[model samples]
Target: MENWFSLLQKNVLNQQSWTTREQLRLAIVYWIEARYHRRRRQRRLGKLTPIEFETIMKDPACLAA
Candidate 1:
């Protein structure tokens, strides 16, 4: 969780290194998709894509209460 947030923050908040916004966007998207999303499926997410599993778990109706 900590690592996930760090990756997002790094990509979103820091864009000065790239000369163009398109370059930065592409780089960030690639990193998120390839590094965090893919690795999460392989290890922590039971092979489900991050967005699919998150959509289910994020719903208020799915709460454990």
Candidate 2:
């Protein structure tokens, strides 16, 4: 959680100034969806990024989840 907050501070909060709560909310949502989750390895998926995990799941030879 510390790491996440640190990154958020550096990448989002520090990079720009927000004039409204709505803008801040949108920025956070966009960051989490576009950058964070796309690249972060998830433990439930055996540490694969969601993109990689989805690709493997689509393969016919891949084991059932």
Candidate 3:
């Protein structure tokens, strides 16, 4: 969590200015979804990215819920 915050601080907070709270929120979400989540690998997921792991495990039955 600390590492994530540090990344956010460096990449988002320090690099840009936001005119509104909503804009800041959206920027954070974009960075998380587009960059961090897509790129980072996890040991629990057998070193695959979350996106890759999800692709491998995706099932219509599971998604329908």
RMSD to native, candidate 3: 4.4
Query: Where does model 2 exceed 4 Å of error?
Result: 61-65
Q: List per-prediction Cα lDDT, in the order shown.
A: 0.71, 0.92, 0.90
* Native RMSD of candidate 2 (Å): 3.2
Q: TM-scores of the models, in the given order?
A: 0.44, 0.85, 0.71
Per-candidate count of clashing residue pairs (backbone under 3 Å): 0, 0, 0
Q: Rank the candidates by lDDT, best first.
A: 2, 3, 1
Off by over 4 Å in 3: 51-65
Which candidate leads in TM-score? 2
* Candidate whose lDDT is highest: 2
Write model 2 residue lDDT over 1-65, tens digit each, in one string: 99999999987899889999999999999999999999999999999999999898788655554
RMSD for all candidates, in order, please. Answer: 9.0, 3.2, 4.4
Expressed as tens digits, the lDDT of each residue in 1-65 for candidate 1 is 89777877776656457778898788888887777665466546667878767777788666855
